[model samples]
Target: MQTESVKLPRLITPLIDALTNVVVIENGAIVKNTLSETALTITNDMPQSLIDSLFQSDNPVVQHNQKAAEAAYTFKITANRTLEAPINLFIIQKDRNMSQNLTFIVGEHAGVTVNEYIYGNDGSTVDYVSQAVVEAAGKLDYHGIVNLDAASISSINRMVSVKQDGKAFIKTAQMGNGNTQQDTRIDLLGPLAIGEIKTVALSSAKQEVLIRSIIEHKAKHTEGLIEQYGVAADESFLMFEGVGKIHKGMSKSIAKQHNKGVVLGEKARLDANPLLLIDEYDVEAGHGAAIGQIDEEQLYYLMSRGLSEKDAQRLIINGYLHPLEKLLENDIVKKHIESLLENKTA
Candidate 1:
């Protein structure tokens, strides 16, 4: 598909420029697929057996979405290669219900980065399912951005499996203006595997948002961590849940979970749960969570400095989310996230 013939959204234009490879899925169909300057293969079809072998899940939503997907895609990275550029995958849902499934395969010793963005419009509903498999010594860095229209509804499920010495780093930023449920799971299936998941979210205007992340350490010397931060305002509801599990006989494995949330309005509700399950006495596991409103003293101090109440609130919200910039490699994508937060808080 020609890039010129298909118009791109204004909010995503800056990010597309920074990414060398781009794929666009609109209304449950592939509208544009462009590839360049990246050592990756993009395909629309994969054997059912291959898909079943790479991904396994008991989540009903994930299973249903996988079977009912209107568009399915696979992105395969070359073995033993390190790619400096990130691949951009954009999904646009407008005026209709849509389901999509995406799979990513990282070959042995390969390193790759992926950035995915989902945008909804005209009260559409979206079901998004994704699976990733990392081979031995492979590394995958993934970032997901979810910004939907005020009346839209979305359900997102993502799963990953890492082999020996493989590592997966995942960070997601959700600007919630509608109803959204997102679930993520990572399994360290081989010795010395590592997984880390982080989330930054903002919910406002009566939106209901829930984000859950789970990491399982199934092999000796494996490590996993989950961290989440969110802000809720204007009668919205926000929940963050994290789970870390260390299986029996996985000696020396480590699992940790942390979650924090802030409430900006009296009616806004925020909840967090940090859960850790350990079956091995030799492993280390810990979990912690905190949920509260913004500190009144901090707001008072900022307002005393001649800042308006709204401006002070915005500054505080920015401080909570600005840490995400360091985790992102692309400056354009970082700025895009900042803009989204700015608009959401404003």
Candidate 2:
């Protein structure tokens, strides 16, 4: 654990005040962690059964990440307590391959929020896996940002389970300067459970980015929603895929999926795929997708106002992605996201 000092991303500067508890992972190992007085507990020790059960996926990359992890952290929030501050997690890879695993357990009636930042240097690769379990009546908010250099590659896999009356929100902002793939799945296992997944992805240069999210409703009165927005420029390729599934006997369940994308360069490509698989007749399920270029009229209108062409284009792109910032409650974080979007557009 080399804990001297590490360069932090600009997006995290606005969150310094609330970063009383911070975890830093470097080169696939835990380098430093600072904890404060709170209802949340962070530990590296967990039951083997729990770890195995949470990482049951058969994907080769998933198994590799689990087996290659040099350090793993589990965050447990006490029951009936609400965390007023968000936990910060930073993972950095420097010119090498790295893998890590994280787990979040929210006790019954408890509420917590977590922000994760994954950064990679040139020629580096990183695989990050996380599992979140929300007990009955518990609430969880998870946010992730992935930013890597042009020569790097990133893979993120996330799984979430919500119990009866539990709620979970998963939001992600992915900057596609390299090759990136995100796979997220949420399962509603008990009655009245709710799950939501929202993502904003930006790709430029020759980067290729893919985001896939799936929400499953397994109990009565359960609900699931998935929304993804993407932008592609400079010959890059971007794709957003969302799936909503309602299992049999899940009466009164609801599932919805929406995906939208924009293409900025003549050679850039964008794809949106929304799918719904419902096995219950009493459930309501729907899916929609839209993919196109920016509105030329809007660009013209902005340019006519004495703004440069690049400025006009950036403004329009920012407007398209602005809605994603509303999903967060903290203004500083929202501003950070806005700056990220602005930088990507520029």
Candidate 3:
């Protein structure tokens, strides 16, 4: 932490998003964080190279409760002095050599929205994690989408620990052509804490997705919901591993696991595993998973009404993506999600 660089509002420089403006912060205090209605972007974007420079410089731009695995990432962000408005950060990879390690700190009564997208031009496989430590009464909402074209691999190692009355929500949407893989993990740490996770993956033609989530309740009145849905076309495969458990003295813990998959090819494969580790009574926890093909009768009914089989398949696949689509509130992101699903239709 330096006296000069610490004067800025945000630690990382605004690089990629030229529309971004400067924020002001000083020694554990938020000087100012506001943008005019006409402003296009309140948050800044920087190139991966520049972001890497700041991390190496190690001169704190703003107070950040952060850490990372060495030599692989570009940005680090801390709440600009006990943040007021929810902070949003974006991580992107354009070159195949790109990789990142990021950490976040959510102060009490403060919240943040971290959005991450992993992509590559010549096919990149990156291992990274966006770890957050949520203090008492704090909240963290995270949204991640991976658009890995053929020959890309990605993993999201995320952990959110809540206080007695705090909550953490994670949502993911993944789609890829060619061959791709993704790994995810989450846990609920405090009593009366809440953890909710939802994910959807679309694979087409020799592509693969391995999805996993673990929910461990450490205190009483903790609640967890894990939902995973995947769709495959043209010989794609999806493997799911889900675990939910309630340790002793964790009364009234509720964990539900469900996965519904649609496979539409002679060679396509779907492997579903749902596991529950219950150690005591007075808890409600269970798992549900199903893998199947689209109904021919439904397609026939639509075809009878003058719709082609191809279009009928589109409707069925769209239906599979609808539940998660309704969950996104942002327009730009929601439309992008629809586009991903649309690409898999044919």
Candidate 4:
């Protein structure tokens, strides 16, 4: 267990006061942790060149986050090792904006799980970026939850690359009653690599939420999946854009995307776009998007069973968000989601 505080430099500080807070990092028996002020600390025996290359990314948002980052936290797992327990990362925002970077490296045949929680007060601004690399035959499971107060704004960016025979699973829940934007990209750079991404979001009270995700398959026999679910009410707006791409010559690759939204208010708005781009032969690719309100027939059926209209709606919402709970698999995350659902229904 280790805790450290990081303060932003004056050059990046705007009208808001300097942001300083403590970050907690816990390393399991199989995983190693490193903390630094300017860059990610690597304790593995990997060459410095390889470690430096992980910091370089082609995504514009990732580059911007790296340039603006004032602090960094890194974790690495050695080859042929599996962590017995999940690693927990905690961040709490106070008076000013937050800009930080996180890096994860998994060695060959290694496996690890990371859970991240981020919370902030009203009117706060947060910028977070995460980069991960999984070596051949490695696996990574990541879950993140963001719950910001009303009127706050947050932007999250993430990029992940998986080598041959590697697998990556990512699940994110955004229950903020404010403006939020999330951008994520996953690249399968080697044969037999697999990636899965799932996201659930809720927006209400004139809030706005935007989610963008891309999965690129660059090698043969690669597979990818993307799923997005959102709910909007009280004149709020939500949009999801997902793309699956298979590069040329990447035969036997499979990519799929699905996006769905439910609008609970007459004034609320929802938009979903799922796209697939393929440039190779013998590849499988598909996408679908659906945006609509709750089913009237289902609501009436519940009401006929002696349940009030509000209770029926709440029941429907609970069922809609229940799938996300399976991906979270944490007591704290479940409690947070329950609280958010209660507030939204009330």
Candidate 5:
């Protein structure tokens, strides 16, 4: 129940103003929370070595966010502890560009859930980076929603690691009339680790979006799943790239990726790429991608039920994105998705 707010001096005074808010609660009581510009205020029991390892990632987006970050938040769950409720993070941008970083660590035998929401004004830009690590037998569930105004830009990057017997689930929904680029990477670093990533995006009004995801299996008996769904309208462009890789020594590992997209307008464009790079002989890996316009048969069936063309199209799009909503498991997020769909259809 601890709430804190921070304001950072922007590099460009007239164009960007940085602001952040954070809240942390444990066992129905406020534990520790502070907001600052110069340093991250974290009160957690995780080891220093575990925190340092997250910064070693080589991803370009991660590097960019880290280099430009003006505010940071870190959350750690004690060993064998379970959070009663998910940690909620809300970020808002007014008229400026901003960069922020977030880190989550789940100790051995602990379980935690986190939900992040980002909203910004038109013409604004935001760069966000997040890293999460689940220790041996730990569990982590993360859900995110991005909603920026038209003409704005958002870049989101995330990295996750699962240790021995750990489980991690990441679900994201991106709904904006602006441009967005998101990259997420999951690493299975211990035996029997499990990871799942699901993302749904809706782009319209000349917006351009790129969603890239990678799942790496570096340990034996690991399992991973990646799924992406997107819809393009009004000349908007969308691209989805999913990559699954199994190291040479990783045997008995299974990885799968699926990417699908639908075009809602004649000028809309969609590109999907599902790739599997396996160096192990005893691994099971596969990928599939499908990009095309809405199914005419489905549309006809919906129209026959007395729905208008616009209504029918909306129904189709909803069906396509329904799976992602289920994965999100949040009523607020589901309402946001419905609102966005209404706007897009209007």
Candidate 6:
């Protein structure tokens, strides 16, 4: 007999129009083949100082795509009212010299789904970037969960843009300790556009994670997919770069990437690079990666079903981070990510 359920959080709505206007720029540049866009709705009650360009004063912190996560925050939206799910942003840095920068924008067919979590790492060490632009048949689902504890330092980067038959989905889950470091990225263009990205990471003692994923397939039936997984222990480290490209007159484009890693100890480490570039050709791209440890017949079938391999590897690394928290469509950001994964801290 085991019962403990008291879940109630599922009320997400936004899209109140008064026509719409929101423009935020700092440490900026948006002029490349510009169609000029800056709008927002939801009863147009803006002006929270657009996060003051993330505490401006010229943002910096580059080196492995850090660029100080510029803009810090310029949250915006447009398209009257209608957001039945997804929207929870939290960044907590309990003193010790903290910093910030965040940017968010939505327009076109206007649909929203976003959940971002970045817990403090003892301050003076947080650089992030969150960007999304999906118009046309607009749709956006984004979730980035990061938890750290130790000396400090954390870096995160995200980018998504799909016009035409727009649809973009991205997810990243990172948990670290032992002196942190995390770098991530994603990009996909338009034209019958569609994209899906999933990521998971956990590095114990002496942690490190560097991941970069770029999928750019412009036009003609564009589609992209990427999946990332990881687990590491003592002296932990991981680096992955999965890039897919198809330029000129991309026809019937298709791209794929997969990365996996598992290392328990003995100075754990992993590096994977999946890259494919095609100028033009009825495209079909591919990439797969793997780095491993921990599979003694799945830890002797979880100690012969008695449950104990440290709770069976923490139930297989939280079942690969519970499917991007079921693609959070709000529900109080899925109960604050189910109370931060039942207080598992990651």
Count of residue pairs whose backbone atoms collide, per candidate: 0, 0, 7, 0, 1, 11
In the range 1-346, model 4's lDDT, one tens digit per residue, is 2123242211112211111222342221112233222322343232334435654666665567676664565667777887756655555565567676777888899887766666666767788788889999999887777777786788887778999999998888787777999877888999999998888888888989998888899899999999998888889888999999999999999999988778987999889988898999798888888788888898999999999998898888777675476544655456556767778646
lDDT of 3 at 7: 23
lDDT of each: 0.82, 0.81, 0.60, 0.74, 0.75, 0.59
Scored by lDDT, the top model is 1
Per-residue lDDT of 115 in model 1: 79
Instruction: Write candidate 6's Cα lDDT for 1-346 as tens digits.
Output: 1012222111111211111221212113211111123343222121234323221222244322223333344556675333554454545443343335455556677777666656553433666555566767777777777765555676665666677887878888876452444444434456788887778776666667776677777677888888788776668677777777778888888888888877777787878788878788787878888778867798788889899877777666566665576654335445554454444323
Residues 1-346 of candidate 5: C-alpha lDDT, one tens digit per residue: 2123232111212111122234432222233334332222354332336545654666666666665566666676788887756655556666677777777878899887766667666777778788888999999888777777886888988889999999998988888678999988899999999999898888888889999888999899999999999888888888998999999999999999988889876999899988899998998888888888888898899999999988898778887776566433555455556767778756
The model with the greater lDDT, 1 or 2, is 1
Error (Å) of candidate 2 at residue 244 is: 0.7
Worst 10 residues of 2 by lDDT: 1-10
* Alpha-carbon TM-score of each model against the true structure: 0.91, 0.90, 0.73, 0.83, 0.84, 0.33
Clashing pairs in 1: none
Q: Predictions ranked by lDDT, top down?
A: 1, 2, 5, 4, 3, 6
TM-score sort, best first: 1, 2, 5, 4, 3, 6
Model 6's alpha-carbon lDDT is 0.59
Model 1 reaches what TM-score against the true structure?
A: 0.91
How high is the lDDT of residue 111 in model 1?
Answer: 93
Model 2 regions more than 4 Å off: 1-20, 29-34, 300-309, 326-335
In candidate 1, stretches whose alpha carbon ends up further than 4 angstroms from where it belongs are 1-10, 13-19, 297-309, 326-329
Better of 1 and 4 by lDDT: 1
Worst 10 residues of 5 by lDDT: 8-17
Better by TM-score, candidate 6 or 4: 4
